[model samples]
Target: MKFTDGYWLMRPGFTARYATEVADVRAEADRMTLYAPVKHVVSRGGTLNSPLLTVECWSPAEGVIGVRTTHHAGSVRRGPEFALPGAEQGAGVGKVRRDGEVVELVAGDLALRVDTAQPWKLEFTAGGQVLTSVGERGTGFVTDPAGRHHMLGQLGLGVGELVYGLGERFTPFIRNGQVVDIWQADGGTTSEQAYKNIPFHLTNRGYGVFVNHPGKVSYEVGSESVGQVQFSVEDQTLEYFVVYGPTPKEILRRYTALTGRPALPPAWALGLWLTTSFTTDYDEATVNRFVGGMADRGIPLSVFHFDCFWMRGYQWSDFCWDGETFPDPEGMLARLKEQGLKICLWINPYIAQKSALFEEGRQAGYLVRRPDGSVWQWDLWQPGMALVDFTNPAATAWYIDKLRQLLGQGVDCFKTDFGERIPTEVVWHDGSDPERMHNYYTHLYNRAVFELLEQERGEGEAMLFARSATAGGQQYPVHWGGDCESHFNAMAESLRGGLSLGLSGFGFWSHDIGGFEGTPTPAVFKRWVQFGLLSSHSRLHGSKSYRVPWDYGEEAVEVTREFTLLKHRLAPYLQRAAQQAHATGIPVMRAMVLEFPEDPAAATLDRQYLLGEDLLVAPVFTDDGTVEYYVPEGTWTNLLTGAQLTGPRWIREQHGFHTLPLLARPDSVIPLGADDQHPVSAWADGVELRVHAFADGAERTVEIPRSDGPGRTAAFHLRREGGVVRVTTDSPHAWQLRIGGPDGVLHSYPAGTSEAELRYES
Candidate 1:
């Protein structure tokens, strides 16, 4: 990805042609085209031998500008492309202005300015302030010694500007000096490879850039040019969109609007999930023991998952339960559902040779084939495994029919895994470019299954525990961090990945509770239990060993119970957060920098995150429970204990296994549900509007959405005047008013009483 040897020279075997001054400009109603020769044209003969790059600029939506630079206009188009649902709306109405030497296109508050008389430069501005610019030699077409072509573009980065979000990167939270490739791989948490590789990055300077390439996009963030983010693709053209937002949250909102907004997962999917870990020997009896164990310990569990090995060995994706392990699949699922537990089954898109459906897929031309017309088979995860041709609608229908059969037997959702291992030498059924389909195959694979689930279940009720994704993959509700080691370092790395993914337009993310590679130590297990239960979706999963808390220690069981109960109690607040994710693209678990973009202190802090808009969570990563976290400027109150701390500073504290730093921001009202046994309940039945450090004249209206269905919501209004806090609601159910301060106090009101007041000393 890096092209320069140093500041003054290019690396060997590389030749580059840069776009010079613009020769001519053609302005249209919705777009503008710039014709630039690679050399400055003082005479007509100067444009004869050199390449003339064609640059086209337009707006997809308000505040988003798309620029495409091409060397050749006759290249064949590819089949697989990102689905931009918002493009059809045509919200970006452009007004073009042609001054003496400058041509400008204004869309909403954002504008693109080009000076035809100067060297090729494209400057993006908002409110007359430059956000970023493409300067001299910024747009390039390069060729190596092998005669392969590449198109690249570089955007300027200001001093002290920080870059984040290239799709679930675990390397470092700040991607300033890293060489990142937007290629999907199955490498675990410790490697530079990522499962979800989105070629989008937002900076601290109030703008984001999304490379509209689905295949391989190589990025050098502040590394190639030392002052710009350079992205290149091995193609004849390069297209990217620059989105302007004065705030990080707004940037994500605009970005997701262009791609697709994340679907709202059901409320029950937000609760604690217990999974039969991968490679572990689990049968009906083992599942019963784990389910009964959690119930006996008073731990709230909402979903029970069965990982791989549910099918017979070497027969993955058969969609049939192994009769020996699960003799009666329907009966087992029915009994588990009777106990109020939803069911999830592990599945992937690959069909092994031993599977019963493999022959059907191969015979029907539903499997990817090599150039010689043979099925592309591999022996990596499973023996003689072939990928399902999702590009073929018949293949997708065949695959969905298998899963539909399982859904008929009472399976609620699926853990769609291993779409990252697609092969590039194979041919897609729809004649998509093979190199492009390597990363894009997951999108089709997940979309087919997700749409099927939406048809079977309702719209908001469909969810997937998907692992691999691309730019538009946020349409699926929930995604988890892939394989991680059972250790403190891996735990912190997982948080970094989640924060990065959240910034990349994903709304909900989760991880393995105690890691996936090894059996965690007691301290690791207990600490991870607290962290995982606080995530957007919590699941206890591992590889060789079971993730039952009792296997670690009795303290682990207690820690798991405490956090699971706390998550249920926090469901009202979390559900609203999830709704925000559905409406906008703001993630449920937000990075500290995303929430506090003005605070330089929060730019690189990835160990901690904001659980929602109100609560800040700093997961304990040490064995002794010692954690150091930064709190933005506020008088934050701990939601766990009645403790207050003034921040704009760092706080170091040692917590027990049962607690970590979960603080509510000042001047926030958190809706606390009364039920601790289940996430799906009447959230407004006996809720508590916990008011935290309201200002003298602060006013807030909180809407609590019901779990039963849409359109059933409870509204509560609160206003603080002098020393009195008055609360009023339009709900028929009883509720309480809790004021948070140094001494937390609670006051209750009857169901028929619609108004209440509490006097407190300021």
Candidate 2:
């Protein structure tokens, strides 16, 4: 992807033609088009032999400029392009002025300028300051020795500028020294590869660059040359959009508006989930033992997942329970529901040859086929597995019908697994380019199952434990890090992957609590229990071994119990974050770089993350329970302990199995839930308000869903000045206030008054 040998030389055997100056300009009502030649046009003969490049500019949405540069306009337009929502049609024309040899097109606060004289340059400015510019020789049509042509664009990267979010990458948080290929792969969390590779990356400088292509895009982020971020695509034209935010969160709000935002997962999905481990012997009795053991130990398990073995071997995704092992699945599921647990069944897009649906799909042209018109089959994961052709409308309908039947039975949700091993040599039914369909297939696959879940359950109640996704796939509720070994290292890698995914525009993320590949040690399991219970969604799953808390040790069960109830008690605060993620595109789990952009220490910190906007969680990564974390400039109070700390600094401390560093941001009000037994609707009952680190002139507002009416809620406002505080609410229920401090809860209100005045010593 890198074509530069040094700062001044091009790679051998690769030819790059640069646009030297604009030869002709055509100004339209809504856009501007230009023709730039690759050399000086001193005479008509000079213009006749030079290569002319076509440059078109338009406004997609407010504060966004879409630019398309073409080398040749005669290339075939292909299918399977990325589905992008239109910004706004027919621009209102804010500013269009031609001064001397420069033409400026302004949309909102973003302006783009092009010089028509010699030394052609395109500069993008926001708020009258240059954000970035495509300088001389920056835009080129490149050709390599292999006879393949590419369109390349090199943008300016400022000093100390770091790029992030090329899509759930596990390499590093700062992408400055990395060469990234925006291609999806089956790589786990251990390598430089990624599962979901979105062709989008933004800088810490408050602007985002989204390559509008579904096919492969290669980005050289300050690696090929010294200070240029270069991107290339193998095509005749390269289209990209420059979006401005002036802030990291605002950048995501605008970017996700162009892509998509995540759906609000159901309230219960946030609680702990226990799964029947893959490749383990599990039946009705074994599953009962695991679920019963959770209840016996007072660990509230909300959703029970059945992994791959739920169906018979070599017959994966038959959408039917194995009759021999689960003869009374309907009755068993009903009984489990009676115990107040939801059910999740594992399903993938693959259909094995032994499955009855394989022939049904293969005959209806519902499977991806070979060039010879035969069904494409593979033997890696399952024997003779074939993929369902999601590009086909009838095949999508056929797949959804099976899920509808399962929903008719008692299945509450599904773990849609494995759309990553898609084949590029096969042919799609709808004539989509197979290579482009490789990553976009997961979007269709997840959307089909997610829509069925919404149909069976109500809107805002559907959820999926998915594994594969591309850009805009965040509309599905939840996704987990795939296939990791059970160890401290894998736990840390999963955290890095999840944090990267959160920055990549995913709202909710989860992972195997105790790892997924091998059996974890009791220490690792217990530590991961604390980390997993704190995630947006938590699930205990592994391969070749059960993930039951007691299986590790007695202490592991206690650790699971301690954190499960803690998360249940924190649901009110967590749900508010989820609602915000659904409204905006910000994530429930955020990287420190996104929240504390001003702090230099937070830019590269991956061991800790911010849960929503207020809580900072640092998962103890060491076996000795020692952790080091950084706090931005403020007085932060530990949510569990009343102890408080101040910094713009790092602190190291050792914790027991029951505690980790969960800090509340200064001047914040966190609503603590009442019931530990249920999470769906008990948030309002007996809710306790925890007020943390209030300073003079600090204001806080807390709200919790009311237990009584439809869409009803209760709210309270607290304003603090030194030792005196004011409280106000208009709810009929009684609530208690815990004035958090090092000493303890100084005062507790027995009954709620409309207005109260109180004084407490800090």
Candidate 3:
């Protein structure tokens, strides 16, 4: 993706044409167009032999400016464009004006300015201050030695600007000085390749850029030009949007508003999920042992997942249970459901040759075919596997019907995996570009299954343990970190990826508890148990070995039990966070930089993250439980212990297996459910509101959502005036009020009290 050999020269076998001064401008109410010749047109003959690049500018939504630069206008457009649901509602909102040499298009508070008299430059500004600019020679049309065209654009990077979020990158959390390609791959947590590749990045300078291309978008973030973030695509045109926000969270809100907000997952899906690990030998008896083991240890297990090998060997995606192992799939699921556990089945979009539905799909023209009209077959994950052509409506319906049969047998959701290993030499049913479909295919594949689940189970109840995604894929809730090794290093890398994905636009995310590649040591498993249980979604999964807590040690079992119980008690707090994600685009698990944008120390920290707006979580990554984390300026109280720490500094401490640094921010009220056995209950029934470090004259209103669905919540109003903390609520259910301090629970109110006033010492 890098085009320059050094700072001054281009690499060999490359030709570049840059857009010069604008020759003419046509202004409209909603958009503006600039005709720029590759050379300066001092004379009329100067424009004769030069390529005239067509630059179009408009606004998709308020505070978002889109610019498209094209070399040829006759290239055939393709299908599989990103779904911008807000574009229609935001139409005709842009205002264009011409002031001397500067022409500006203003949408909301953001404006895009282009100077017709100067060298080609597009400057984005807000409040009359420049956010970023595409400087001279920034818009380019290039050709490689093979005669393929590429269009690229570069935006200026400031001196101390830091870039983040290109879809779950496990490399350094700061993406500056890295070459990133927006291509989906099945590479695990250790590689440069990512399962989710979104061509969007936000900076510390209060703006974000989203390349509106589903195909490959190569980005050189302060790498090629050293002072610019350059992006290129192998096509006739390049379109990207610059979204402006004075804050990082506001930037994400605007970006996600243009794309899509995440769907609110059901409350039970936030509880601990136990999965039969991949490649492990398991049947009904093994599942019963694991489920019963958790119950005996007093651990709350919400959903049970059956990974691959639920079907017969070499017959993946048959949607049929292997009779040799699970002799009674329906009966087994019924018994599990009776024990208050939901069911999840592992599935992918590929149909193996040995599967019963493969022939049916191939005969019905539902499979992707090569140029010669033959099914595109591969032997990578499964023998003779063919991809389902989701572009074909009939194929989507046929595939959904197969899954509907499993839903009939009591499956609650699906682990939609392996949509990253797509082929580019095949033809789609709707004639989409093959190169484009390689990454966009996962969108269709996940949407078809997610929509089916939404139809069967009501809205806010459908969830997927999905692995691969692209831009706007946040509509499908609950994606997990894929295929990590069982080690302390991989655990930290997984946290980095999750935080990065959160900054990208995803709301909820999870990871394998004891890792997925090897058997974790007891220390690793116990530490991961604490980390995983603290994630937005929690799951225990692995490969070749079972992830039962007792397999590691007794301490692991105790650690898993304590955290699972703790997570269940934290359900009301998490549900409110999920509602925030559904309303705005803020993620449940936020990075430190996203929460503390003004703190210089938080710009590069990746080892720790904010669990919600209130609690800061720093996962222990060492075997000895030694962790060093940063806390912003506040008197923060630990939710676990009664320890209070003041910061704007780094704190290093060694914790036992049962605890890590989970601190509640100052002046925050966290809703705690009384029941610690289940995530789904009447959340307002016997709830305890923990008020932490409420400063004088600080007041807050907390809304606890109902467990059944959205739009139903219990409201609690709290105010701290002088010494007495007053609390009032509108719910009829029983509740208690607890004033928390360095010594936990300084004052407690009785149950069934709708209003109370208690005096507390600061």
Candidate 4:
């Protein structure tokens, strides 16, 4: 993807024809077209031999702009294109004016200027200030001898600007000076590869850019060119969107609205999920013992996942219980469900040669084939493995029938894993270009499984513990950060990845609760318990070791119990945030920058995050129990101990094994459900709304949903109106409100209390 030899020289065997200057511009009602030649046009004869690059600009929505530059207009677009929502058609074009070689196009309040002369720049301006600009040689169309095509674009990187989000990246939280390739790989969390590679990045400069392509995009961020962020793809046509957030969170909101907002997963999905560790020997009796042990230890376990070995070792996706191990899968699932637990099974799209479906897929043309007309086979993860050709309708139906049978056996969800190891040399069923199908394969794979879940389970109830995704894959509710080592640094990296993912518009994200590889120490497990429980989704999974709390020690079980119960009690507030993520595109586990962009201290803090809009969680990342977290300008109260703190400063403190710095923002009302042990019905019987440290005469309203309504029911509204705290619960039932601090109790109120006085320490 890097084409430059150094700062000044182009690599050999490639010709660079850069857009030099715009000769003329034609303005229409809804679009502005520019004709820029690659060289100087001294006369009409000069325009005859030079290549005139045609550039088109238009406004799609308020604060959104689209630019398309083309070398050859008549080009065939291949299959496997990203499904982008059409721009709001009412995007009217307004006035156009031209200076010497600079032409400006105005659409509403957004203005785009094409600098034809020096450096051949494309600049976007709002009001009168410059937002961002693309410098000289910023856009190009490329083609290679092998019939491959590409489009390249480079945008300017300003001083002190930081870039974040390209989907669940495990590298440094900030993406500056990193070369990010939008290609999916199973290269575990420690490398430059990523399982979930999204072609989108948001900057601290208050605007976001999303490469509107699902295909593989290679981004050389300040690597190839020192002053620019360059991205290139293999295709004739390339399209991208520049979304004006004005704020980082708003940019994500608009981006998600365009692609697809994430769905709110079922409340039970948020509870602790216990999985039979991968490659561990387990039968029905073992599963029963693990489930019963958690119950006996008083640790709530909501979902029980059976890992890959559930099926025959070599024949995954056979979808049949190993007759030798699980002779009665139906009965086993029934008994587990009766004990109030959901069942999840590990599954992937690959079919091993031993699997019966392999022959069926081979005969039906449902498997990817190489250039020699033979089925593509490999022996990487499984023996003689052949990938499921999800591009084929019959293949997809064939794949879903297997899942439907699992669903019929009482399995609730699936851990849709391993769609990242896609092959680019194989042919797809629909004749999709192999290169284009590389990253997009996961989209089709997850969509098929998610759709089946939606069909089996009703709306708003389906969820997937999916691992790989592309641009529009957020529609499937929950995704987890991939494998990690059992260490503190890995835990911190996972949090950074999760926060970065949230900034990228992914609503729900989880990681292996106690790390996915090697046994974590009791202290590490206990600390991870608190961190995992506070995440948008929580799961206990691993490869070589079990993630059971008791596996570590008795104290680990106690830590799990404390956090799980706390999470269950906090469901009312968490579910509201989940609903917000569904309605708007903001994530519940938000980065510090998203919540407090104006605070300079927040832009670089990746060790902690804002849980929804009110809570700040700084997870302990050291074995010594030390935590360094930042609190924005406010009076924040510790949710664990009754400690109050003032900030805009970094606070470093020592935490015990069971506690970390989880703070509630001032002037916020965080609803706490009455139940703690169970999450399935955490919708609340009668909620106790704990109004946090509000300023005197400052009132806040909280919504309390009816118990019978959806998980996100009722709204409680409290506001400081007329120097009085006016409180109203949205539900008709009687709701109780209480005010308490480090000193015992302050006051209490009934549901119908229309007005109340603010209580504070005298």
What is the lDDT of every predicted structure here?
A: 0.92, 0.85, 0.91, 0.82
For candidate 4, give the lDDT: 0.82
C-alpha root-mean-square deviation, each candidate: 1.1, 1.8, 1.2, 2.3
Total clashes for model 1 = 0
lDDT of 1: 0.92
Model 3, range 622-651, lDDT digits (tens) per residue? Answer: 988899999899888898885889988899
- For candidate 3, what's the RMSD? 1.2
Query: Candidate 1 on 222-278: residue-level lDDT in tens?
Result: 888889999999999999999989899999999999999999998999899999999
Question: Per the 3 Å backbone cut-off, how many clashing residue pairs does candidate 4 have?
Answer: 14
Q: What TM-score does candidate 4 get on C-alpha atoms? A: 0.95
Worst 10 residues of 4 by lDDT: 738-747
Off by over 4 Å in 4: 86-108, 115-119, 141-150, 682-684, 720-725, 740-758
Over 4 Å off in model 3, which ranges? 741-743, 746-752
Error of 1 at 498 (Å): 0.1
In TM-score terms, candidate 2 sits at 0.97
Which of candidates 2 and 4 reaches a greater lDDT? 2
For residues 1-762, what per-residue lDDT tens digits would candidate 2 score against the true structure? 988788788899998898888899888766888788898788888978568999888877777788889988998776787666546453564356688988887877888899787587888898888888888767778999898999988889887888888888778778898999977788888888788788888788878888888878898988997688889988888999888877778778877777888988988898899999999998999999998899999899899999988899989878889999999988999999998888999999999999999998988999899999999998998899999999999999999999999888789999999888789898888888877788788889999999999988988789999988888899897999998899999999899988888877788999998999889999899999999999999999999988999999999988999888888888988888888898898999999988988777888888999998999999998889999999889899998877788998899999988888999999888887778777776675567777787888889777776656535677788898677889888756667677774345644454456677667445
Clashes of each: 0, 0, 0, 14
